[model samples]
Target: MNLRSLTVLGAALLLAACTTPLQPGEKRYSAAELLALKPADLSWPATSTVGERALREAAVADIRARLVLPAGPEREAALPKLFDLVAQYNAEIAAARPLLLQALPTLGQRDAETQRALLTAAHTLYATDAAPLIWPLLPQLTTSKPFAIAAYTLLQADGAAADRLRVMLPQQFPSWADDARLTALMQRLRPSAAAQPPLAELLAAPLRPGFPVIVSLQRPGRQVMGLALVRDAGGRFVRDGAGQLFTSPQLALARSGLPGTITNGNTPQGLFTVVGAGTATNPNIGPTPYLHSKLPVEATPAEFEHVPAPGAAAWDEALYDSYLPPSWRAWPPIKEALLSGRAGRDELLVHGNTINPAYYAGTTYHPGAPQQGCLVSHEDWDAATGRLVASRQLTLAQTYAGAGARSDLAGYLIVVELPGEGAVTPAEAHALVMAAGR
Candidate 1:
């Protein structure tokens, strides 16, 4: 058989293996059964009509139910099918946008929950497939909380798009017009006599040549789900070969547990470098063998001579400097304190957790779970037994840690707040080129 035929045959076999004999009176669909479904099976109406609204609602409900099933091979197998269905659902939404806009004349009249669902659909569709149709709707839809968050996120990922958004900002965010931070960033974004590189290119310009991994956490806040992106060897910030951005499959990082902060539970934003590495040794969560990269808060200025401090115009650097040892300079941690300007604590690390395997192993994590200050991988559960266990987080940690062992790949980790509400501060945006002699 040809490749196409072979692929179809393999998929059919995989789907077949996922099924089980039905138990009498068991109304719920088995995980395998769900995996066997296709986008066509969802019965989404082909055309935009009044009936399409109910169909959209019912389809999302079905997707969510299947998503909550115990994480396992079956669930994993089902995700591709589910994702396909989501793509179809999103296309339907995109087609129905004109109707959706006409039906809901004002943001106040739209159901908050439904707006959230549409926002989520747009985010999922764009992040994975780079669906272009949703772009025009994003600017107008920002009146909704969810839509605003997603639009900001999209702008961060595609810096070139910011040029278009700069024009719309005054209309979309009139109140932010006078905001100093926003104004500064807008000025920087203005087209100069000499053409400017896109933000993504500007961020990538500083990296040492070859395959160095850069992990960026954008807009990590109490209610907002932070996004993480990986810069692979090809210099592309992508999740996989499937062309999806690594927005989903991210950890709901803990709110700052630090006392006396703007948002007490907020995750502090800043540019951080990996200082050390190790594995978890806790007895209660004993012997979870994944690699962990340490972001020690107390590194001295002498250690980072290549990295300059923020300029005089930058935000409060003194506060970040306070987190360092007193023996270090009394000034801020970096020359520009960006998100770290207000940071009062340290010992932040990017590591996997073993304390609650079940919670981590599932597709999502409990946002309320506290952390001293760390970036963790989303835990994965076993497919067959539906038991919480070690997940892809361990794999990623191992991969990153292993890469760090190589001399050429040894690089810094920088954390910054998302660029909308908090503009990318000077400290956060500086080129992170590694030391030359190394």
Candidate 2:
């Protein structure tokens, strides 16, 4: 396998192993997965193609070494398109952002298809404006299958749109590296042939070894957590690895660190949820948090600077990860209807920001701290024997007790995901953990 095979999301799959060290190939997401996300914009850390790897290295460097503050529009204009890509990636990954970049070259040519894509994504990105033509512009997506498929994929991930691409990609998603595979999947989008799947096996659940079993998380408010995996004797999960734990001082800090505020080498620990997934920018760091949403889901090196974070002392000041904390949460049990396939050793995290004014202020379950940051694991087992007799696994840990504490040097929460199932619910889960404390 190439470097892409060893990409980050793979490694993240194993970090849920609380007591054990994070396994290799543990990652949050890959470049391909990022592409699939089709955020509002697109960008990278610049390229060898750009030649100038560093901002200063760019032959067309913008700011004079003296300009203390460079937020002026002059700076924006002088910055390389590559930098625009970088800045755009950090702000928001919504379709509008991507269209600004992906459709740029075509827009200059005034391609009708390009215009349609730009407009379609704009509705979601800039919802302020809407009129009679919003409906008509949509039909163009069918004519421009490539743009349509990308849009379809984004919404499907959000569970807000239908998988029209399914009508296009009946075979499989092609390789991101191999140009050939990509072409084949795209070619199938033509209007000539039957674009639907076979019928006989349609309604049936297609003997999926086993379905994704649900698991409710406590602290059921905005900060609710989620995942589905099981454990072994070594205090690790025996089956799937959705909640694999990374046992790094840096990672531990980030997990238990304060949120919104930048802190030490330690990441913050307030209430947070898994929003989406992405590739880790730091190769040294395994399985950074997975960030999602059609909006901003990344961070730049500058973000880790002398900011107020939990592990401020531990903050590297040198590295950053593409991963981000969540904005809202659905909890792990919802994945039962979301994720489908034969789950192997995998850890698919989907979280959101823990503090939501609307949900927390009004909802009954006000999940906070350890409960909000908790990673609920789901296990599919023999209903009777209670033995984890299936493939779907259980998440095996919980949040730290003193997650946000600046004191308690060695303080940490005793972990166990304990995804709620048959007899357990969010309230029940919390009560059990609380009782155990006694």
Each prediction's RMSD over C-alphas, in Å, is 18.3, 20.5
TM, every model: 0.36, 0.25
Q: For model 2, how does the per-residue alpha-carbon lDDT over 257-358 read when each residue is reduced to its tens digit?
A: 111111110121211222224333322111223332110112111222212353333312121111111211222221211111111111223222111112
Q: What are the Cα lDDT values of the candidates?
A: 0.37, 0.25
Off by over 4 Å in 1: 1-202, 207-211, 238-248, 255-265, 283-297, 302-344, 355-368, 381-390, 399-409, 419-438
| Candidate 1 to truth, TM | 0.36
Q: Which stretch of 10 consecutive residues in model 1 shows the poorest summed lDDT?
A: 13-22
**lDDT assessment of candidate 2:** 0.25
